[model samples]
Target: MSSLAVRRISECFVKPQFSNQICNLTPWDIVMLSTNYIQKGLLFKKPATLIDEHHFIQNLLEKLKHSLSLTLFHFYPLSGRLVTHKTQNPPSYTVSIDCNNSDGARFIHATLDMTIADILSPFDVPPIVQSFFDHHKAVNHDGHTVPLLSIQVTELVDGVFIGCSMNHSVGDGTSYWNFFNTWSQIFQAQSQSENHEYDVPISRQPIHNRWFPHNCSPPISLPFKHHDEFIWRSETPLLRERFFHFSAESIAKLKAKANSESNTTKISAFQSLSALVWRSITRARSPPSDQKTTCRLAANNRSRMKPPVAEEYFGNCVHAVSAETTTGELLENGIGWAAWKLHVAVTDLNDRVVLEFLEGWLDSPFIIQMGRYFDPYSLLIGSSPRFNMYGCEFGMGKAVASRSGYANKFDGKVSSYPGREGGGSIDLEVCLSPQTMSALESDQEFMNAVTEFDPLLF
Candidate 1:
């Protein structure tokens, strides 16, 4: 069994150079109040030829904490707390970020008596990985009392893991990756320079202004008075999580097959991959032919907006767009049919559809209830293959593996990540019931498409 030891726990604040600022929560941010925090981590091999392991790890922790403080200066909203306002007469709630409070982000350092192989060798994700992140089951609304962002650095026998837990209300996957990449860039720059300064200019500057349609105002209020009214803190059932890697060649073959079978050129690689997994999981469950199934895709609205919101806008700018069909139709029609359905659903989510959803949301504001939002028969696919997961190099080297926390995870939850090799490859982190996972592993057709990983590669 693996053992973990904690070395330190401290709050790292932004530099005193910037003044206090306030950021109002948009409808995008408000909708995520009840969801779980976004947890992600990267694994790297220890530096070669270390004189003393303890000394090296201590030095690394100091550098990481310093760089994080600098990074928070630009992402000030993350370092702040969520402030809520309530009204008795109307029974409403309003939430915003008070950047002036400056409580700072949480930083943790620890050591684990395990090797990197213990993490990457098993077919199922090791339960020990969950210990790498704090706020295991806490929701975004908890940010009111807890730190808005918490980071943990765990040193393994031969490698290190850096994990982050950020409130979902503050941003989506886009914002999360942006903050991570920027921090890595700053850290890398400081290591290369002699003075160890964090003055390196970031490639992208995040925009804090909340976005809304014309005629719509800020401080959108919810009908509920307290977060407990909608928060879900139920215990999740036992499940199995596994990483499936699809190579560049495998992906191209799937795409070509999907497009050819569907006789349409617009079927995208993402749609194709989604179709494959959707069908595989559905088959594994062995549901009745008449059973209704759904595929919910997380779409970014920055480009879908009419005038196009800035790509660098740093808040939640994503929506869940779904495609539905009967189990019989989804499986009987083949991968092309499923892919086409996903393609149509994604392509149809244009500016007009987005505007109508926003206008309707203004009329009736409600936080997405955790246990009630997703259907048991449905699959929710989050994250994207386009994110630069392997590019977060902090002088040690490129990340050897990418993993997420236990936040917002359900039986049918799936998160897509870019492959470590950096081609057109893709990796999916799939969570499902033990029975369903067992059935999926035995599905010959599905297994044929998966690219097996060798533990030694880590």
Candidate 2:
């Protein structure tokens, strides 16, 4: 089979939801940001501040000065760009983290799909800035705009629901895990106990990111159809929902069974489940030819340090774990067998390939060119060992359902989380086109699974 390396990389305005105007500007007129010499963080207040000027954008400098941690976590050098000069155009947008209830759990709920259709040319700073956040990139400003993660809420099955969108660059399944963990920690009101107390535990030393390559080495040319092709987030009128159960106990048993099935050695539950997802997806869509198909999974290397990159290292620090195989071989091997292959693929993550993969990204500005290759985003397998969605406190009631998906320009998205009420396993959310959704629903093997993921479902 052939393969290619991936490189890197919202908001909304709904007036009925709030009395305030969604945007201070009109439809056609570009926001003329103010040319005022604003101070750092002036544009950003706690939770989020308002955009005062019509043409001004808070620069990287000011964001840092205001809240270094938040800024660092929010802005990245590669994907996230800052406006150095002041503008008369209003700040491209504004963010407000609010809470209506006073519960420990909270959600950073937002609705942002207002677009400018087709405003080309970089010189158009106002419209361009507005569109920049268009490709909601997932990166701590990595040069490439990838690995983005955010949640969206929508109406489905006569009910409102949330969908999550994550760019490949911002992180791997683990990065989400890490971020969620931090989210949960904060929600749990355990921020102080976790040492995130306005803290910058620089740990040892800052590692120069110039160590990784943007994409794979030559001869291994980039794979995929095109760069701009993204699985736009979209919604369907017919709400297809289902749910799965994966208690910690069941997961433990599954882990042991998976390890036992492996010929060589031990592997984590992640690898095992990843195998299940990969195999199931492949089985459902058997390729006409035996050409190898790749199930690219991302790997995170945050806590590997003598002193881990602070939980605050809210940047992209992940690599993909490519699990490849042809339909013929997978069908012959069955689920458990194929899973072991995936296990082998990432078992020794601290290996040369993983290291080099990381080093290559930092070694050059290549990430910029590589971020556009991923789509049909799904957390076929993602978890938050640390996040407490139910515990977030935006001064609102705890989020009954901490959703990580959104309804946007894409067909469908997959999000998995611990069942609604408490913790442990996760819930997988789906957002897809009717055709694809129908196909899955009809496929007896994976029928009616939009609501949940049972390893046996596939």
Candidate 3:
């Protein structure tokens, strides 16, 4: 593998449409201040008709930057910086986005002498993939100094990779992917138009007004005087990250088996899969039979709200719904029981539950930290199989693979992506301790359900 080389780095700002805009962070956003940045990327095969790699890359970079500038106009908050203010009387801290002094998003261009196959062929994701993103160890609150959004475009020997690192405090997974999809739409529109400077209209207009329950106000101040009081920084443990592919057939089987064994029809495909993962990982770890294990999943609260928020509401609108059980019961009762438990947790997370969580946050403001929110004994699942990960063509072609950075990675962190084959198939990006991962690979029952993929299929 040849060394990676940096070609250029610059800033891309939103089109000058408006000025002096400021968005206050709500409790949903405030809770994410101490969390890791959202880092994700897509892989695209180089155009076959291209002859001059240098010229192709240069043109692609320019178009991407321009399209991003246009996209940022709709997502202007992304280009702004997080401003922290200290209140004297109350002696608290407040965070907000200052659009007037926007620094714009960071844009990086680089080149690598490796094929797309080199990235997708491995069972274990190559560590080099992490280098494609910026702000590796930074948290969301670092948006004050670091750009709220960072994009890195790496030209490969046979393909290209577009990686982005966005402040988690600015948005959740829904908001993250909405920005991505709109950006790609603008890029593709530019490619087809004769005018290089054409401004395309966005398909879905984003709603910037932060959501909060009645009687709850903006500028929610935290009790801490300094961010360091709640900020968490720890050494990451040795872990192995691998992609587990579940075909549509396998998904059906899991769902059917779960529902049949539980003797209920309320189980969903996601719940069934989650149950399988929870049980399998528990069995692999072989924890004490009486030990308590938990699984927390990020649930989108848009539809769960009484008066549902628009799908395009552009901020954090998710809450972590969790299920807990004893290792002995989870293992003995089988995947159906485990999945049923997950279903109940999700079903019970109605509008009242979401309102309660927000109300409690108002009384006592705090941020999510590593050791406090998650640990090795539990699992934290984020992202969703429904996201249009493969739809980001950018006029080059359909994405061949999807990857994420090491910003918020920890043992038992799982991110889900839509499978390349589509049609209800799903791919899980699982991270676990080396010992647990080794055990998971050797577990026949779990491996039997995973769909084997040929590297060339990617």
How far in Å is the alpha carbon of 338 misplaced in model 3? 0.6
Residues 375-418 of candidate 1 have per-residue lDDT tens digits of: 77899999998998788987678888999888888889999999
Over the full model, what C-alpha lDDT does candidate 1 score relative to the true structure?
0.86
Candidate 2 matches the true fold with a TM-score of 0.49
Which candidate tops lDDT?
3
* Per-residue lDDT of 244 in model 3: 97
Give the alpha carbon lDDT tens digit for every residue of 55-104 in model 2. 22223222212222231232222122221122235422221111121111
Compute the lDDT of residue 93 as modeled in candidate 1. Answer: 76
Stretches > 4 Å off in candidate 2: 1-257, 263-265, 305-310, 362-364, 368-387, 394-397, 405-415, 421-423, 430-436, 442-458
Please state the error at residue 10 of candidate 2 in Å: 16
- 162 Cα displacement, candidate 2 (Å): 9.6
- Compose the digit string of candidate 3's lDDT tens values, residues 1-458: 53654344454444435536899998899888888899999988888898887788888888898888888888989888999999797576789998788768888887777788888888899888888888888989889998899999987888899999999999988899999999999898888886655457778888998887797777777787788898887666888999999999999999999999999989999999999998888899999999989998889999999999898999999988999988999898989999999999999999999999888888887788875667567898889999988888787888888899987888888888888889999999999999999999998878988998764565
lDDT of each: 0.86, 0.34, 0.86
User: What are the TM-scores, per candidate, against the unseen true structure?
Assistant: 0.96, 0.49, 0.96
- Candidate 1, superposed: residue stretches over 4 Å from native: 2-16, 88-92, 195-198
